[model samples]
Target chain A: MATEGEGSGFAIHPMDQFVIKPLFGGEHVHWYTISNVTLWMALAVLCIVLLLVVGTAKRSIIPSRVQSVAELVYGFIYNMVEEVTGHDGVKYFPYVMTLFLFILFSNLLGLLPMSFATTSHVAVTVVLALMVFVGVTVLGFMRKGVGFLGMFWVSSAPLALRPILALIEVISYFVRPVSHSIRLAGNILAGHAVIKVIAGFATLVVASPFVVGAVGAIYGLELLVAVVQAYVFTILTCVYLRDAVGDAHH
Target chain B: MATGTETAAEAAGHGGGHAVGMPQLDFSTWPHQIFWLLVTLVVIYLVLTRLALPRIGGVLAERSGIITKDIAIADDLKQKALKAERAYNDALAQARADAARIVAEARAAIQADLDAATARADAQIMAKAAESEGRISEIRAGALDAVTEVAQDTAHEIVAALGGKADAGSITAAVAARLKE
Candidate 1:
């Protein structure tokens, strides 16, 4: 039997990465690069497509259990949209539901042994954030024209302080996507790093079953955090979309 | 110099200077933000346009159709009920008119019967009065004949008691003398 460190240290752990230059070598890439993250994202998208197609292929007056579950999910998202964005929010229900389901599944997939957590990468998260940011901005402008600019200004504040308030508001509005992206990436990366460090330490200590058990418990906890983080990200996206389309006063 | 010192420390710990641990953050390899941004936008756009929006629209349309059909069925039932109510009222009015005609006819028949009975009773009373008048006249004639017979018998007895050949004036004088003595 091979010792613990004998077989290339657990076969490189799949997602573990180090910087390397290609043979042609104008640029360098990490072991777990953007290409890997893109592949996983595509996989997650495919999973969602398969889920929807399979869930809704058969239509029945009294639905089968699978179809009922699918309808329940649809209703849950619809109610959430209505709660956050009122009745008009229903039009955007599909986009919001897909975003939620895709991210949730991706996060769960990452929890499997040797699976890559694509959400841990800042680039991928940033792209998701930027999409939301641009989408809302476009919708705002399309709905309200030049008046969309007034969302940052023309608050219920007194006229004398309007300029100063508007400046702060504009800066905050610009920071929305950055904060959104960073919050998700930071949480995922930190959680994974901690688990990795603990597991590494666990290997060093022998005759300490307690330590191993504790680490196992923490791993379970990390799975819960994964789901929660996905939910939080999707809910925040909905709130931002609501602000973009709805009246600012509300 | 710092790199040399780190390599020396690693070599002292192990036979070689191969660092084996988690990698440090390298922000330099970050992708151009615009490229990823465009990719995400396109993905979101496609998702909304191709999949999400159509499903939501189908659900809403199905729900609307159900509601409209329910309303139409409700309206049809209401119209039927209204027609039934109108027909019932018409039947009730016709019944009332028939009842009134029957009542009037019964009252007229009773009035005619009473007038005919009153005429018959008056004729019976007139016939009884004429029979009673004829019985009263016969009884008066019988009483007058009895009075005449009694007067003739008294006159004969008085003549037999006086004498055999005595005239009426002598007998009258003799009877007066006998009474005076």
Candidate 2:
């Protein structure tokens, strides 16, 4: 927010891309105002439906390319959910899969030139992270009841150190959503910002070629980060859900 | 970056009510973004649960079921084929056994016929031999009688020629008694 790359004749304002404005000609945003974030998010769902629903309309034993993709994603999520959370947690597979697909699509689609990244915005990611946090917490309490609190209560330590460990555990447990949301957003935000910074350096006459090359290379790395961040976010959700169903805490 | 964006915004004549900070930090759009996110997530969830997931899961289960049923049917057919082969073998063995029994009966019947023919031939040969022996005896008797008469004549002539006392009847009786003994 403090740096200015306007020393050269070309004043490249990379952070301007992150600005959220009303889709229509309006100075103020309303609750129902159509925005770029809304458009991209809807597009993500459209892609998902097209891929999953339309692709598998035939449901042939021998899958078409579209059906293959849909089934592959389904099986991938199904196996991950089963492995991380066990069969007992598979009942919630649809919800977890939905979240994973939505985030994955958002991250990948955000990589398009001149496109907005939904996952980079805390407003978007916080809601997703909070959903997992709340859902898992509710499930934990419902399934394990008071025993769920035992996660924070360390039993294997000396009596004096036990309280300190328990306090630390409690703080860390509450920090799950904060870190979960911020981790994805921060990774995406940092990558995009770095690319913008490198692109802005392309305006320099002497360093133009190197800066452009570096930007291209960073774009490739950003693509990997896009998928990896989504994977990490999803697997972490599965791990938390496992704690809920299995209650490894106690 | 602040002055640069401001200068750029000024150059574009897009003046913000307050300096446009990080668009993500803009609280005014949070409601818009969050509201849409919530709506979209709910929509995605409903779409998946209602349509996409169940369809995909159903296809998988149906494929598995088809494969399992096909395997079971194949197994059933294989078992039937084995049963047919076993029945065919039993029938083949029965036919071989029947053929052997028939051959054995035919040989026994032929042997019985051969034994009867041999017995009849031996009886005929014995009868022929008896008849021939009877003829020979008769002929021998006739020859013996002739020889006795000749011996008697010779004896009588010798007695007459030598002028000695000799009887032809006595000589013939003695010769006949010796032949009988």
* CAPRI-style quality class for the chain A–B interface of candidate 2: acceptable
lDDT of 1 at B80: 99
Stretches off by above 4 angstroms in model 1 are: A1-35, A206-208, B1-181
lDDT tens readout by residue for model 1, A25-60: 233233333443455556666665555545555544
Report how far residue B47 has shifted in candidate 1, in Å.
6.1
What is the Cα-based TM-score of model 1?
A: 0.56
Q: What do the candidate models score in CA lDDT, each in turn?
A: 0.63, 0.84
lDDT of 1 by residue, B1-181 (tens): 1343343223222322122332222333245222433454456447645764455446545766877998999999999999999999999999999999999999999989988988887788778777777877777766655544444344446667665544556655555454456
lDDT of 2 by residue, B42-65 (tens): 999999999999999999899889
Query: DockQ for each candidate?
Result: 0.04, 0.26
Model 2's chain B TM-score? 0.44
The interface root mean square deviation of candidate 1 comes to 8.5
Q: Candidate 2: misplaced stretches above 4 Å?
A: A247-250, B1-21, B77-181
lDDT of 2 by residue, A98-187 (tens): 889998999888889889888888988899999999999999999989988888777888889988999898888889999999999998
* TM-score per candidate, chains pooled: 0.56, 0.72
